[model samples]
Target: MGSTSPPATAKCSSDWFAHKKKNGRISRCPIWGDIGEKQNAVDFEHSFLRAMRASNIEKKDFILEFQLYLTHGSPANDWYIAAAAAASDWDAFAAAFWVKFPAPKVQVRMPMEYEWILTELRLDEAKLLEHHPDTNNYMWKCNEQANWKDFTNTIKAVKKQEIEEGVEHQKLLEKTKAEVAAVQKGLWECIPPMPETPSKALGHSLAGMGFADNSRGRYGRDQRGGYAGRGNYRGRGGGPGQRNSTPLTSEKVATLAWNVALLPHHPNTSEGLQAYWEQLAAWAGRWGREAVINHEKPVLLKPGMSPVASGECFNCGMRGHQGQFCEAMGDQTLGFREREWRVLCGHNLPHSSGHSAQVNNVLDDDFDTWLSGGLGKGEGSTD
Candidate 1:
């Protein structure tokens, strides 16, 4: 900004100007430090020299008028500069003045978008300047010294950094949107069917029933995935021909079939099963029921007795078993329901998809009033 106050010294006599009027008067600006605006020292010096040429001012004249040019608050009024001014040598005084005040620096401003970022950085301005480009210029102590050159470069780098980070933020926003969309689609699926849109056919990218893949990836004890009920897979999975894990030759099959056909049926219980085995051993039939059971004495386990008694090997159908000598049972195992099937059929039948599911159904669906020992069914039941 230019100075508001006019110079104390009036313009010099116009004899020189009148002489130049024959050639036209020289155009001029106010004396730089007096009436002229103080933008920079360079412009000040130029205007000073031009004013000197226009006035035929002697070498000593500037030193004399220099005091009139300076305001009361000017740096030239300092003790050192004032002492130099007392000397009549204009050159020495100018040199001393120049030393006290270096040339004014150019101004630079940061972009508005990064103004907040710069302000935040200045919260710890020391840290912000730690990675400065002009640290080697130790002569300059602050940004005012570096002004538009090194300082400007540093801000440019910061703007580039902000732009790069903004791109990453955009990418993260897109990822978050996709995740939110997926959650919305899943919540929409939980809503009940509407008459207008009977099925939410957004497509089955997710793993569930009624999806595009028709994939029932989710399965648990709820029978969500089609599976044989408990104690199931007995007839067909991982067994000899079917549920009969021990492979029998045609001769063993023939021998076992005839004898099993003549055997008496037994109720499906611990006591009934034990009695049926004892009864088979004493049948007095020419056909052998089981070679091991027939040859060895039958073990009669009374009710409430320990099942760990020395007797038949459930795993190998052998007596007084030595595990190394006895054959291992194949994959199939007989639980309570499987034993009932065996007792009724005489032999394990191969599972066929065409056959109906029988006794082994959902819990309590197959059992009825026959036992009726549960909550309200029995005599001890609460009314």
Candidate 2:
């Protein structure tokens, strides 16, 4: 039975040292501890009462011997009096001991006071509940208050919605200026006017007699009764025997009766032949220049004419020979003298004293071979 004492093993090693001396040390174990030793002993008694009232040591016996040397562990000369009381009472020792310590069941935490929960919430809900331990429902206390006229009625409702959008943009600019003055008074009552007549109102009152009073002038009623050139005084060329004899047929009525008889044969006119028979009866009653002065022919020329001969070139105006014999005037040369017809026996020779002596001896031997050589060798020879 004495051998049974082996079971004691030194009384199970003194009951495992009395259950680790009532479960305390091995670094205060919670499974191999270091679990922020009671939040570092409440941050060493809130940094030893914030370094003994910032060294002014408002002696409550030097802040109870500096909270008994930071609750007995902050040692190194109590961190040199909690670093000289956090350099002179750093804000009343960070508001009485780092915001009145106490909370610390610790899983590692210390930065306290969190600016009193960012002065009670709203800094974007206190930066989204700081690192949330449900941020003590954003704990506050540093004076609280607000509502300045609900922020001045939200800035007077955004300046009364920007002054009612500037009075609806000035009533849409006065209804776009009354619809553009009623579309310019309905386009000035749709246009119209241009009609006239009584010989186009007496050719716009004898357009100072040179006629351009529109419809290129030739005043009133002439199909064959009277007024046109006055020849009928009603009888035997007086008023009714009616005969200024119409007849003229047209080279634009002899060039509008030679431009209305050169506007009254202006040699300072003393009624130049009665203003050339009233501008040759108003250019033979409207531009048929009395049929090219009764068919004697040749008139066309008017586009800045000057001396343009070779068939009078209105740049080929009358459609035939002009632009200098126009093979579109490519090589230039058109001089023009050739109108010869002197037949004699076959009869056509007329144009004033028959000529063509073999075309005037071939134009006098081409003007004596172009005055001896200045040009004739194959004519103005460019080669």
Candidate 3:
């Protein structure tokens, strides 16, 4: 009201500046330029009130002195202009100023990863609230949940999730255990346990091989060789690990024990054993020089192995060769089992014995060439 005659501008009566003198600080209250880029109208208002309060300026007359707080073009100046026109009391003007440029609120740092938290982690605002963080980093949660102030009013909503996860994990473990048990039960049904006694196990194996129960004593040996005289098959091997030597498989151990038990009664057992070796030697001499030279084991044939690769000969009922390569029989294409299954299934699979199939077999010379390391089918070939 100091310049009412000129209507130039309003200023604080002399009393307003007295607070500075009383506090022994001569600097005026901070000038809010409302300068570049800090467009925070809200913060400007809070700062102005804070200074007024700190200075102990009586709130009733603070409005008249408010222009002292602002510089040109500041939101404070704008509020002061409006306030000067109609504000009857300082408190009334302050209330209006607050409505226009409220206090600076704590804003949420606009969250980026909330979608992943919401969808992938399956967390909602309620779940975030449940974590009950102590004194840091709720700006995101404040933004996500209603808003900072109303949120101050809304966000108990986690111990429950742990209980739910535990339940699910327990259920999965039960299902896995059930599946394993079912497979184990099937295996038990298919392969009964080996016989407990050595003799009984040998007898069972011989029976499976179509030998009579007493025939275990009759096979593999008849005396007359030095081997039968030695009578002890298990010797102390040179290595410590092999000291108590036993055959690798339980079945072989059972068979040897059965034969050993009958050793006293079968003085002629070595004769059969010697004859068996002679026949094996003759077979190797005729058809498998590799066994003589390299001491290679005989071919191992398993069920469902390729018949061609295994050299299974239906004509001679032998596995070391295909019928085409069998010295004992003529060439054939379809193996006996293949032919049988095909006929049983009523399929018109062509027989391998036909001229076309026979033509496919390499000559014996070609097989010999292949064995000498030249490339060929390396299998069943005719003379």
Candidate 4:
């Protein structure tokens, strides 16, 4: 008779089982117990079954093989052995081994909602969402780990800090307001009229006063274009002096002086106007003594009355000058000292917006001559 053939599934030889057998247990068999990875257990099961089939091990012997491979130290290992012993067929045994080890259950954790976090924190959802954190982890911690206790504690701490800052700021503001009130008390009558309305007009009034405190421009120029000093006025050009110079006649000087003196007499004069005249008086006290004396003379231009002795620049109405000449004729930078005199003295002179004094027409010839000879394309033009 021919030798019996091995089963088609039999791949392992008796020699392989001989190597696996050591003493009583299968020594070289893979252990299934304590497998951390589910895939590892599955892979071991596949290979172990294939080896058993190839070796042509009987069903009863398969249990012994499982006992050797699925050894101690695992709950699943114990269950797998019992499953293998009770299994009636190969398919049942295979199912038992696999049931003990399945792919680790996939754990899905949902992210916390941003709106829920904002609600828990008692923050404005609209505002907080608009801001961003430096890292996703930090933001996650804020959203996930922050509890009601933490939220309440943070709110209390922030409120305390804000209150302290507000108190300090209010104290400073009150002190400033008090000091301002004191300063304003003395100038109550002098302060220009405050607007009747308390909204935009009040803001403008406060701002205007602030401007006056900071610089000369606020008080220096009036709505009517009156300036207290020499620099700003482009004087009515042309006279007996430099044709470019706005020289005042005897009549114009008298008129201007009266207007200035009567400004303080007006019904509702502004503080700036009052202050301007006060400042001018102070200046005159220091420099106008001799000019005052010369002014008393009946004829300012008459011979033998030294213009220098008069103590004022009659050409510009500034102190310390002779009537024969004025610095204003060529220099535009002479400050508005002469203008103060002109405004105070008053005149029917044309407004700044209107045409220049008609006197310029008559002085055209004199102006041309002076421009050709005196003011060359030279020194003063550079400015």
Q: Which candidate is the best by TM-score?
A: 3
lDDT tens readout by residue for model 3, 193-299 = 54688565433322212112121112233342112211211111000011122223555444433432332221225654454334444434344433321111222
Q: Write the per-residue lDDT of candidate 4 for residues 256-299, one digit (tens) a residue.
A: 44443343322224654455445444444344434432222221
Per-model TM against the reference: 0.19, 0.12, 0.22, 0.20
Rank list by lDDT: 4, 3, 1, 2
* Better by TM-score, candidate 4 or 1: 4
State the lDDT at 382 in candidate 3. Answer: 38
lDDT for predicted candidate 4 compared with the true structure: 0.43
Model 4: residues with Cα > 4 Å off, grouped in runs? 1-29, 35-39, 103-383
lDDT of 1 at 304: 26
lDDT of each: 0.40, 0.33, 0.40, 0.43
Each candidate: RMSD: 31.6, 37.1, 28.9, 28.4
Superposed by TM-score, candidate 2 places the C-alpha of residue 357 at a distance from the truth, in angstroms, of 26
- Give the number of the best model, judged by lDDT: 4
Compare candidates 2 and 3 on lDDT and give the better one. 3
Quote the lDDT for 278 in model 3: 47
